[model samples]
Target: MENNQEGILLTSAEQSYLWTTYQADTMAVCVFNHFLQHIKDNEIKSLIVFALQLSEEHANFIREIFIKEKIQIPQGFTESDVNLHAERLFSDVFYLNYIKNMAKGGLVTYGRVLQNVYRKDILSFFSACLSQSIELNSRAIDISLKKGLAIRPPTIPYLEKLEFVHKQSFILEGLGRREALTGTEVTNLFANIQTNYIGTSLATAFSQVCKTKKAQNFFKRGKEIALKHIEVFSSYLKMSSLPVPGTYEQMVTQSKDAPYSDKLMMFHFSLMIYSGVGNYGLSTAETQRSDLVADYTRLNAEILKYSEDGANIMIAEKWLEQPPLAANRRDLAKG
Candidate 1:
């Protein structure tokens, strides 16, 4: 709320966005670098290069802003988190899909950040990020479709007449056979299935490449959890006679070579877990079926526990970076 000769001071929301973006882009640099190691297809390689460039630029921009504000820069993931000399752990197709998924995530994240930004400079930066993510998402989708890897959702018949729900049975699932899924419900189910599929494959790859026994075991458990959630989501579509999206788990290689440090892998996996919780919560709110809601609630609870366990592990190893926090007035007074 205060400004100096330097510039307008950062609000808590603005500060949070900058800090989170800095950390995410730092991890993106390491991730794309590792992806570049095994990429054989020129098309996929170019996409990865573009993504890496954006991440680097964003990281630099945030670094300069932090310097101007005199805030200590976060020690985010860096080249030390990755090994370019490592063997290929993922196929080229997987690289393409990973970028596609990441672009989708970026779109959601940048939109949220844009809403929180109050300063003109910060708004402009996030606006640029949002535009870039839109273009990146389109490119990724085009490439995936061309490569025959895109798993589109099922199309429904056009509604001839608009009608409102009359009976309570419209939202019921306990007694009789449930009615057909609404378009919104179908979309969420398909989206969550896709998310879990990617999570499972990424976790599987990390489990193999992670350094310490603890990290490896953690990834293995994450993979199992993701697989279980995928099954649950897929079954809902199956019950509706809808086609389920396929996974890219087979794209992961048997290489045990470490492409990234254990700390980086753990942090990346934790981010995906937290994102899944958000997605599932949205899905639950959009659905009307009691059974679907119950399933999402149960899966969300499971992932919350898993995410907490991961945080504890990161804390034990002192790998978790502390976010910006308010000063403890009581502690200062005591001192």
Candidate 2:
């Protein structure tokens, strides 16, 4: 790493990632504020506050970078997007799990950004972000474990001996001849199931409080897709005689009160949908079984369509922020 990285202009990767991080952190601040208002458990409250602090700090840090470069800072989520007095829509355990999943997303995002960015300040920022997400993720797990609410991944029996695959069918699908699920395959399958579980719970809650019929219908569709994805992922685990993880639907409450604005909720759901798509893509790559690849490919397409519909909703609502783009030489020449 060069010490004079600041002299170099920000790469497209650096600018776009910082831009996205600003939006996500700001949204997180609003969410934590709303969560803080209704949390009765002191331990969970402190964790929420810690998570909020990181988001606030991240936003401020990115704002300084934008200002120094004369880039217009995005008007990300604000206090207007959250209603502090809204009734509780989630239980304490649900709050913890949400934050855990949130940190999981942040880790993946920051890691991806770090790989593409080289500017010194941006590198430092994302490095710190990655570290903070690790801490936040650890704390969430710690709290969950202490409270006996952690969702553990399914376990497979330990390998008793070194083995080699004797058939090309190890990578192929057949009528009745298939190898057992590999550990990596199981890992991806279980992780996808867990992510979709969170999505299903959020969809359930978001659908309950959305004011517009359109948004409500969107969330209901999302919930159905999430539930279906979970079922499909769980089938693989069940085939290996592993116990499939259950849903977090019971973590949600029946409250009809809206804690966050429709726009904020919509953006939040979009973030989850995008992350879920990435998870599926990664699972497709790491998984060895042809059946798993086929399933992931099909489900990935389903969510991509859902994501496009969600983006259209946000654009219509004027809630989607435009990212930095390339200059149009044709338009410039015409002008």
Model 2, C-alpha of 231: deviation from truth (Å): 1.3
lDDT of 1 by residue, 1-335 (tens): 11223557899998888998998899999999988877899988999999999999899888888888898999999788999999998999888888888888888889888887788778888888999999888988888898887878899899999998777777886655466888999999999888888888988998887877887788889888988988998888888899998888999999999888888889998889878998999999999999899999999999999999999999999999999998899999997
Clashing pairs in 2: none
**What's the TM-score of every candidate structure?**
0.96, 0.96
Tens digits of lDDT, candidate 2, 173-212: 7734575888888888888888898888999999999897
How high a TM-score does candidate 2 get?
0.96
User: How many clashing pairs in candidate 1?
Assistant: 0
Cα misplacement distance, residue 194 of candidate 1 (Å): 1.1
Poorest 10 consecutive residues by lDDT, candidate 1: 1-10
**Backbone atom clashes (below 3 Å) for every candidate:** 0, 0
Cand. 1 TM to true fold: 0.96
